[model samples]
Target chain A: MSRASWQAFREGAYHTLPLILGAIPFGIIFGTLGPASGLSVEATLLMSLLVFAGSAQFIALGLVATGTPVGLIIAVTFVVNLRHLLYSITLMPSVCHLPLNWRLTMAFWLTDETFAVAVSRMAPEHRTQFHWYYLGSALAMYGNWQLCTLLGVTAGQWIPGIENWGLDVAMAVTFIGIVVPQIKTRPKLLCAISACCLSLLWHDWPHHTGLIAAAIAAVVLALTAETMGQKKETSLKTGSKTT
Target chain B: MTEFILIVGMLAATYFVRLLPFALADRMRLPAILENALQYVPIAVLSAIIAPAVCLPEGYFWIDWKNPYLMAGLVSVIAAAIGRNLVITIFAGMATALSIKFLIV
Candidate 1:
């Protein structure tokens, strides 16, 4: 609300400009897919506004199209979004000083892009208005997503079977883009590889539960890999220290 | 009505998952092991979603011999790894997939 905070906020929004460009196609696709998946326009918009998770929304649409039980749909989406918990954990130290409401807003607005942008922008430890900057980025992404969803919904009616045009492949590629940068470590690479293989192997599982199983497997493997890594690092440190 | 509840359910679940950590993160410290595991959640989950979607586009168990989706996905991944850009990765993947799909299929 202060001038400095306002400026930080605006700057955060400005940082999201490139991310917004990437998000436009995704949002439009979600909107286009929603109606084609048999969701009413209102329902699709409402989902975008309230749920606000692109991947989860897409999974929900797939499950809904298959007439999967509501409980199953909810479960699948919940598991898919469990990654946000990690984002909050990563971000907690940076914004721990903020009040509960601000924290809640940040969490609600947290997405892959916003988290990546906001975390990078929070370098100045002494700065008081980093939360405002985060809010700016979050709000920018949030607004862009909703607008693109709206456009996708409107464009959906005029375009038939737009969902079947292999666009989901693009999403898969987007997943690759997200994965490649993060696999800098052996554990991360293993986690990614195992999860990918298991996902294909588990593809036949009922109720789309394979995703959760694959994720859990990946996490378990990653933990094992990381613990071994830590042990090795500590031993090396101790060895060097003694010598 | 069912759709609305589903939407609400999704909203509640998403907020709840995203919110609990934000709220509790300050109150409690995550264990070191748990913290390390949590770090992998994003990569694991994204791969879990992408692998099947690309490898088995048609159904629970399906793989085309040439696998245009798979081929295109690999191209995209290579493009992204080399370019370090999302737009280029997506466009390149899309372009590869569409061309293979049209040319071969």
Candidate 2:
């Protein structure tokens, strides 16, 4: 509510614009596909409103179309979203000091885009009001999602072949932009490379289990590299001291 | 009614996983090694997601050099490495991908 909070909120939303743009194509496509997949219009919109997770929603849509059991759909959604658990843990330190209500609200809105934007912006300088900025990013993404679903469900019929436009490339490139800059160390570079290779090799795994597997493996590899590097440095120091 | 149940089930499943850690944040004390791993989570996860999006654009491996998505992804990487601007990197990649899709191959 303070001017500073409002400014942080706006800045958060501003930084997330490219990501927001990236989601438009996917949003509209989800909207159109919901009905085509035999989901009632109300149910599709409700899923977007309540679940608010893009990947899970898409996977669920595929299952629903195949007439998969509801229990199976729910289980797959949980599995696919397990990656968010890691995200929640990673971000816990930053939000632990905030009130429970704020944390809960943020947890609900923690999509990939919002997480990417919020984590980068959660610098010490903005420590006090970073939640406001996060709220801004989350709310902006939420609003855009709803609007895109509306466009897809209602107006999507009028625009043919929107899915083939390859607009989803926007998201892929945006992610590259976000991740490449973060690769400042050799360990991180290897961690990312391992993740990429593992995910590709395991791409066909059901329920996006591959993504979670690849991420965990990559993290473990990076930790090993870091620990080895530290040990080498310490050993060298001890040897020089003896010399 | 089944659809309603399905929706509620999904909402519960999705929200619970995301909320559990935050709810326990105060009590959760991660080990130093795990904390160190957390730093790599973002890059690893994003890279994991990006690989399939580019190479498996058609839901199967298509790792050709001429794959437009691959080409555009490389451009975005270079742009980010050189420019370090999110907006510029996205624009450069999008322009490359779209032009190749619409104009060339």
User: Residue by residue across A1-243, what tens digits does model 1's lDDT show?
Assistant: 788889988999997776676577778889988877889999999999999998889889888888889988898888778767667776766777778888888888888778766666645563488788888998998998899899899966587766666656766777687678778889898999999999888888865578778888998998888888889999999999999
Off by over 4 Å in 2: A123-125
Candidate 2, A19-125: lDDT as tens digits: 88888888999998899999999998998999999989988999999999999999999998998999889887788788899888989998999988888765578
DockQ, Cα level, model 2: 0.81
Task: Score each candidate by Cα lDDT.
Answer: 0.80, 0.89
Clashing pairs in 1: none
TM-score of each: 0.82, 0.95
- lDDT value for model 2: 0.89
Question: In model 2, which residue pairs have backbone atoms overlapping below 3 Å?
Answer: none
Classify candidate 2 by CAPRI docking class. Answer: high
